[model samples]
Target: MEQFTEVFLEFINSWGYFAVSFLMALENACIPIPSELILGFGGYLIFIGKMSFSGALFWGMVGGLVGSLFAYYVGKYGGRPFVDQYGKYFLMKKSHVDSAQHWFDTYGISAVFFSRMLPVIRTFISLPAGFAGVNLYKFVFYTILGSLPWTALILYIGMALGENWQVLRTIGHEVSIVFIILMVIVVGILYFRRKQKR
Candidate 1:
């Protein structure tokens, strides 16, 4: 982990905000780039006076929008049959894809906005939004709104924590893990309860 952190910091330090933004955009598009690390390091850069807060936020948002659009285009052009056929290879379930499509249908552009704030789900949400035929302009607008604040928050935490920035990174990872676990437990309990009621 330390080696990975060192390599990441070196890359970010050398490449600066552009690298951070590009990686962040890729991360959002399910590239496994670790958004927390990028944002945290970016924040640390800001803390050390290497970058500006607004600059970080701007690039982060741009990266997010670009990455999301990549996924959206994939879904739009690939269609449901393509996803149903190949998504499993990517560890994606048909039901999960279907659910996201349903949510997009029901909530419209707001689904894009809200999903961007979510952790793991945010990565895949844009595809469904596109598949559901959300307006392109609305999609971009809400995606920006949803993503900018999320990016800003992570950056702010890093800046505020300063030398203790690692704590924020640890907290982000732990919280995401805990949240996923709790969600699984809740789903399991609800499923069994529904079976009993039936």
Candidate 2:
């Protein structure tokens, strides 16, 4: 994780706004890149006058939106078939896929909007939105709306902390760990319940 962070930082340092956009795009495309690092460091740059807040924010948001659209299309066009064929390899079953699809159908707008505020879940929600065949316009709209606050918040923290920007990175790391553990526990509980039902 540290290594990946270093690499991303190096990219941002050298490439500036383009790096922010590119890295953010990759992050939102279901890649493991963390936006916290991207925007947080960007905020630091803003504080130091190396980068502008509005420029960084705009590029970051645009990149995220573009990546999300890419992932959404992938899920819409290719996800269902891929999941159907190979989901079991990833501990995903037809029922699980169906449940996810149903959940999106039922609560897609809120889910898409709120998930963006979360740490880990935000990165991958686009795929499910696509798989559920959510309305494109609605999906895009909520994604933009949801991502704005998160982007702005992290950037603000980075800028506010300035020289102590690493603090936000540290906090983000810990938060990610907690969320990951909780997710694992939830998945384990659900897996066990499914086994019992079977």
Candidate 3:
């Protein structure tokens, strides 16, 4: 995780805002690139006067919108049946995939909006949204709305942290671990409950 953060930081440092957009697109694509570090570093650049807050924020949001398209298409076309067959090879579980769909169905707009600030949920909410046959305009609209707070907060923190932006790298790593554990627990509960019902 640390290495990933460093690699992304270097990549962005070299290419400026383009790297921000590119990497963020990949992150939203569900590639696990950690937007906290990406946008935070963008903020740090703003602090140093190398990039503007608006540029970083705009490109970051654009990248998220573009990146999410990949998952959306995959879900729209391939769907649960497709993921069910191939997911294990990629270390994904059917339960995890289904959970996203369940949440989107159950929570509606709030799910999409709040999930954007969460760790794993934020990364994956789009796929489920796609699976649920959400309208394209609605999906894009809420995705942007859902994305704004995190991007702005991380960028602002990165700007404030300046040379210390790497602090967020550590936080991002920890947050990911916690979310993984949380998912495992949720899955376990769902499994046991299903068993008892049977």
Candidate 4:
């Protein structure tokens, strides 16, 4: 993991703001790329005079918007058939899909806005919005509103932490991995227990 981190740091350091923006966008698009790492390391770079903070934030926001829109469209046009067929591959269940759809129906665009702050939930939230046929304009507006702050917050954290930013990056990565593992375990346990009950 340390070696991989070093390699990633080297790559980003060499590539500069463009790499940060690309990684941020890919991460937002449900690609499992850690936005925190990009932002934090970018911040450290700013501290070291390797990159500009404003440039980092600007590109990060652009990447986030692009990636999120990709997910939104995938969910919207692909429909439940795609979800039902491929969701399990992504650790999603039919009930989870149904629940997200229900949430979108009940909460509307607000759900999209709020879901942006959640960890794992944020990745999948767009699907329900798409499946529910939420207005594209409203979806984009809410998504950007929710996502920009998230992108900015992480990037700022990166900028602020500077040389010691790796501490936060490590913590964030561990937390994300643990969260994903726990979610899978909990979901699997619930699924089997529910099957037994039924």
Whose TM-score is greatest here? 3
Off by over 4 Å in 1: 1-6, 84-106, 173-198
lDDT of 1 at 154: 83
User: Which lDDT tens digits does candidate 1 get at residues 36-107?
Assistant: 788888999999999999998889888888899987887888878887888776666666666667767787
| Ten-residue region with minimum lDDT total, candidate 1 | 175-184
Off by over 4 Å in 4: 1-4, 87-106, 170-198
Winner of 3 and 4 under TM-score: 3
How do all models score by TM-score? Answer: 0.76, 0.76, 0.79, 0.73
Highest lDDT, which number?
A: 2
Better of 3 and 4 by lDDT: 3
Cα shift from native, residue 109, model 4 (Å): 1.2
TM-score of candidate 1 versus the correct structure, residues matched by position: 0.76
Candidate closer to the true structure by lDDT (higher is better), 2 or 4: 2
Angstrom error at residue 119, model 2: 1.5
Candidate 4 lDDT over residue span 93-187, tens digit each: 67755765666778777888766656655666788777778898898898887777666666666667776787776577454456446655987
**Ranked candidates, highest lDDT first:** 2, 3, 1, 4
**lDDT for each residue of candidate 2 in 1-198, tens digit (9 for 90 to 100):** 456788889889889999999989987876667788899899999999999999999999999999999878878888778757855554444664465455467776667876776666677678789877889999999999889877887888899999898788669856445654665598799999999999
